[model samples]
Target chain A: MERSTIDLWVGIFVALGVAALLGLAMKVGNLTTSNIGATYTVTANFENIGGLKPRAPVKSAGVVVGRVSEIKFDATTFEAVVSLSVDKRYVFPKDTFASIFTAGLLGEQYIGLEAGGDDAKLQNGDKIIKTQDAVVLEKMISQFLYNKAAETPKAPETSGSTSSVVDALGANPLDNTTVNTTINTLDNKGKTDIAQPVAP
Target chain B: MIRSKLLTSAIRTLRNIGSRFTERIWRMGAGARLFGLIVVSSGECLRRPRLVVREVYFTGVMSLIIILVSAFFVGMVLGLQGYNTLQTYGSSEAIGVLVALSLVRELGPVITALLFAGRAGTAITAEIGLMKATEQLSAMEMMAVSPIARVLAPRFWAGVIAMPILAALFCMVGVLGGYLVAVPLIGVDAGAFWSQMQASVDWQHDILNGMFKSVVFGVACTIIAIFEGYDAPPTAEGVSRATTRTVVTSSLVVLGLDFILTSFMINI
Candidate 1:
């Protein structure tokens, strides 16, 4: 084979190889996205979202059914309007309750929809009226601690707050008074133990 | 007298710098020609299976054992380190995911390419340089035989074919390594680790990306080495210079290709 011909063939092969790899990658990616065909959009209103961010999974009965698409608050209601993308085909009854659920003990919070009665299926953009706000574990723990503290009673006070304790120690009562004269103090100093023993 | 001496010195420095710049330009031009020669030669070699097979055995298969061993240990270390971090959050199962991702995405291809560049790149440059110095290529042209088809083509093809296989081996070994460390050492169940690894990783993209990077690395190594070799000046000193340049250039190309491949593959 001619040298130039060979270079041409090699170049072709390289291009073909890249094309094949790309096609395979696209096929695989499509397979993953297509498997769960059913998707629905559900909205939840929260007074506070806390750390609940978008792209968080929307789960139903512990299985991830969709993801939170957006989070914003309405000007009139002053409530967070979180749009969740649930799989199509999985029908949400009209009275279904949407609540934020946390995975594990400290994992990211996601939207969890509980199936409700009422045979009518929820349409797109329909408001899920029954919505529960995010239950932050830390906040709950702090509240529990506060309630426990409130339940506890204070101990009763004792009589000798200050002065009685000082009297019990047997200090002289006249020395404690401000009215004692300087002459009275001088007389007691010589007669009592307050008088120093003078040696010859 | 002082002015004359200063003028002479200035003239000498200018002449020296000018010659050095010209020399660098010549070397670069020659390097580029050599690269073209390798691509041409590799094309020719594709028609001759015997020569290509011999080169593949020496360049590709021979390096497999060491590559696999390195990959295994790398995976094990990744698993050990990842387990420690994930353990704090009670998500130790992520150790497998970490190990597999690291090996397949980065370590395997980069390490194998570097090794191939050091070994195959050096050898190609030296062999081609020596051939050029001895006028074998000129002799082949005199005989109406194309040297590029027979010599350079095989090396390039071998590089392209060998890299992905080596990387795959690297990834496989790494997973086993991770298993070795995670299961017995860290008390993780083998079943759980393997299952988690399979579930978490998007296997198609990860494996395909690794293979894609390897082929690119292979082409880069082959081209750089061939370029340096074929472009070498017609002296023994030139051959040595070519060999050094081949190793340096190929290593840089491999790293540059890796960065580009990573950006495209992971969108990072």
Candidate 2:
């Protein structure tokens, strides 16, 4: 057979193969238009959103039921309002409480919906009245420290070198000064209690 | 002293301009040859039926499996990594978007093309170089056969036609990879990943742009390899050099072409 004859067959086979693979990719990429499931929306209000973002998934009983679609601040109440898109099939009781939950340490955050009693199914656009504002761990720890600092009495000016102890450990004593300044700044900015050591 | 300094400056400027002009001429000559070669070969393909079948097999079908397998694993990794990151923020459901976007935009086409370049590009370069070295190309001329039509046309067309199909296959495998890993391994429901992906991707222009990039890559690789092979040195060492140049030039051109096409398509 001629080399040209061989080339022609090769081309046909390749074209067919390419077509098949494309079909497979569309299937795998979930690219077909009909596959997307149903969606429903729920609303919630909080004093501070604290960096909640759209497209964050909303979970109930550890199962992801929907996503946070929008967040806007209500001017009248100065409250942060969030709209969540839930799967239509997941019905929530009327008194459901919603909280903004952060994933593991250094993780992305999302909304968590807890079922409540009242025997009424929450409709689309129905509000989740009981809501918890986002909690920041760093803020809470700093607040605790600040309160402890206020309760403790200050040391006298004659206090023997606190720097001497750090020097004994072969590290920079000025590090302590920097740390103290940072703590002072955090206390000032947050208005929360900063933990301080009590002098005997 | 002043005269010498001026002479030195003039020499430097002339050298710079000369080098620039040389590069420009080199590019223009190569481009013209490629265009002429494509026109000649494509015309031959239209005139004859046998060449088309060979091209379909060599350029298209021969490469199908590799593209599909590579695409699948790439997709799987995308899903796993994306899900982990999103999991941290409780956005694990967006794994679909991550997998789909990456495959469509960058990974699928580039990887498929590179693999094709390695398989088809190397073989074509070797065949042409061997033919040239053995004087078979000259013999074809004696027999009244236009080597460009008989040889170069089929290879060029193969590259042009095969690349997109391979890329599409690669993309499909990748998406499947993502689904398997995300849904079963990572616990994302199959419905959610599929749904999110469908909502995020816009097929019309985006798919067109990606396939267009693949076509460009295919043409560039084929032309570069053929050019090097056709002009290959007479010795065994010459053939080796031709092969190396073909691979290096094809890979670089593919990447460079990708950047240019992507920037033009996205306006970024």
Candidate 3:
């Protein structure tokens, strides 16, 4: 090839390389969005993030509406604070629940936003009050094994109340004033230690 | 008596072959030596951009057509195979995910490097082997210049840079080829194909990792090719044997490295 021909070919080669990389970033990487649009940030704190990482997809009804921009640990609160940058096109309700979900049974984790019936729109920098942690397979398996081992074949309690088992599960006296107040309404509130782990 | 004599000869031949193999193993090159060479050549790479660019044009641009054509065919094959399998599950649209994941995570880098080894890598080995045979490298040494810097570094570095770029091109073209087969031939919805891929693939994890894998393959193939050529006995037969060695050795190394790299990139 001549000098100009070589240069042109080289240019084309470099361009194709870049195009392929961008194509990869777009098609196979879920990096299509430049994050350079009319977007707002909202925070959600979870007890455990599991394998969730920054820039993991934030999906609503399985549609990617945003990205997880940041993940940080709050030492005092003992929670994972995740900041999501949602597009302006999708406005979420105030009572929206954000849950960390695995892509499959044991895949990369992402944030799944479940919109609530509330009419109020979440504003920038607003915090999502209700959040669920990741369904860690390891923890669930271990808990299952522990529960199986602890099944003692004891006779039914005299109260005939599931709360009787809850009382035996070592219900925290301080838990009533803290997180997961919804669990307290159920008679078997103490059974939630295996379901929803308390922050250590 | 005849059977016993034949068995003894066979055993002697086996011992001879075993000793030769052991000798080759004992003469294996050191990592410290390769590292030193890379350090020297990498510095030369930094000093001379024009030389590197020229070599890249030769090594990379020349292989474009073969890479594209092969990748397109491979992608088409993947589309057909993946569609056939997934259609049984009533999820043909997810063929996009299958094709993209296979190409980005495995096939694209591995196949492109394999092709590159056959094409530019052997060419590089032969060219350097010929130079060594003709005493061009020796002539450069006589002129008080380092042939390692002038002759070897730029070409070696160019091969390293070009491999990843070529692999990327292969991936892009392959995805298009897959789309063409899936959408037009198989009647898969384009939206589902792309959307499913978008939802599942991770940029930093899948795509970038594939690129990194290609870069590493490039360095390995080029080093093997150049080293074999430079070390070849200075003759026409030597050059030819060196070229053959470059192709076979690099192919095996690429496969082995691919397994190691895949283990690191993916979780079981």
- Give the whole-model CA lDDT for all candidates, comma-separated: 0.73, 0.77, 0.85
Going through the candidates in order, what is the number of backbone clashes in each? 14, 30, 0
Candidate 1, residues A1-200: lDDT per residue as tens digits?
33544444444444544543443233222225424565667787888776798767777898767778888889998989999887886778989998877777776788888999889989888888898888877899767655544444432233753443333333333453554576677678768865667778
- Return the candidate ranking by DockQ, descending: 3, 2, 1
Winner by TM-score between candidate 2 and candidate 1: 1
In model 3, pairs of residues that clash are none
| Model 2 per-residue lDDT tens digits across residues B1-268 | 9999999999999999999999768865975677686675578788775676666677677777777777888988898889879899788988988987888778877887788878888878888999999999999999999888888888787778778777776777687788899888878987877776765664644565667778788778778777777878877899988888778877877888888888887732
Against the hidden reference, what TM-scores do the models get?
0.62, 0.59, 0.70
- Which of the two candidates, 1 or 3, achieves a greater TM-score against the reference? 3
Best by TM-score: 3
Tens-place lDDT digits, model 3, residues A58-109: 9999988988999999999999999999999999999999999888665678
Question: By lDDT, is 2 or 3 better?
Answer: 3
Residue ranges of candidate 1 with Cα displaced over 4 Å: A1-59, A64-200, B1-51, B84-90, B234-237, B265-268
Candidate 1 C-alpha error for residue B33, in Å: 5.4
Q: Give me the runs in candidate 2 sitting further than 4 Å from their true place.
A: A1-200, B1-28
Error of 1 at A40 (Å): 8.9
* Model 2 residue B137 distance off true place after TM-score fit, in angstroms: 0.5
